[model samples]
Target: MASSRGGSGAVGRANELEKMSIEQLKALKEQADMEVNLLQDSLSNIRTATSRLENATTALNDLSLCPQGLLLQTLSLSVWVPRKSKKL
Candidate 1:
């Protein structure tokens, strides 16, 4: 792939830096700095996406407990409420 070729090309350049002219070295350093910035931005986006997925999962789990809670409340009310007795 192109990415693999680019990775090897940078490794090859590392070995040839001493032979390069000052202008070429400066340009190479600038390119490397830009790549570092791009990778940092990508990592930040991934972290934000992961946090959002975790929050969504927690909300879904809480919603699933709602029915059980309502059933408990109804059962407790029926058991605790007393009926009036009729006189014979």
Candidate 2:
């Protein structure tokens, strides 16, 4: 036997939906359409950001494989290191 008090499963929900007016159904459909549009826009922005990040990562990896001296020159930065003194 099904308990009738609290939990209304799919059948109960379907019965409730069948009682709604056409205008109410139209409003619900419009709301759902807006939600889908918003989600699509968000997904597009995320894909663009992901593409940019991947490009940046690839560029960095390429730079890493270059010799340190060339890398420093390309970036126009200089580093000075002291030489060790010869033993007496």
Candidate 3:
């Protein structure tokens, strides 16, 4: 019957494991801090890259209008010619 009623000692042993070592806690905190710093650095780099891309997109849009400007210049080349042989 000892094997059928021996779960209380296991529970008491589990309660003893509730207190963690200071070194383990410190290591966990340091790892969390490092992750936070790395994420902040990544976010900063992303902001920088996004700002540069926005500037490049704006420059591309401004340069794309060049062809339209040339089209306006070409409109002056159309000249009306009168035909002398018109039967009207």
lDDT of 3 by residue, 19-42 (tens): 658786788779999999999999
lDDT tens string, model 1, 35-79?
Answer: 999999999999998998887788567657665423322235223
Candidate 1, lDDT over the whole model? 0.74
Lowest-lDDT window of 10 residues in candidate 2?
71-80
Clashing pairs in 2: none
Candidate 3 ranges beyond 4 A from true positions: 1-18, 67-88
lDDT (Cα, tens digit) per residue for candidate 2, span 26-88: 998899999999999999999999998987788678767865555232332223233344569
Instruction: Give the lowest summed-lDDT range of ten residues in model 1.
Output: 72-81
Best by lDDT: 1
Off by over 4 Å in 1: 1-15, 68-88
TM of each candidate vs. truth:
0.59, 0.63, 0.54
Assess each prediction's global lDDT (C-alpha) against the native. Answer: 0.74, 0.72, 0.66
Candidate order (lDDT): 1, 2, 3
Candidate 1 root-mean-square deviation in Å: 11.3
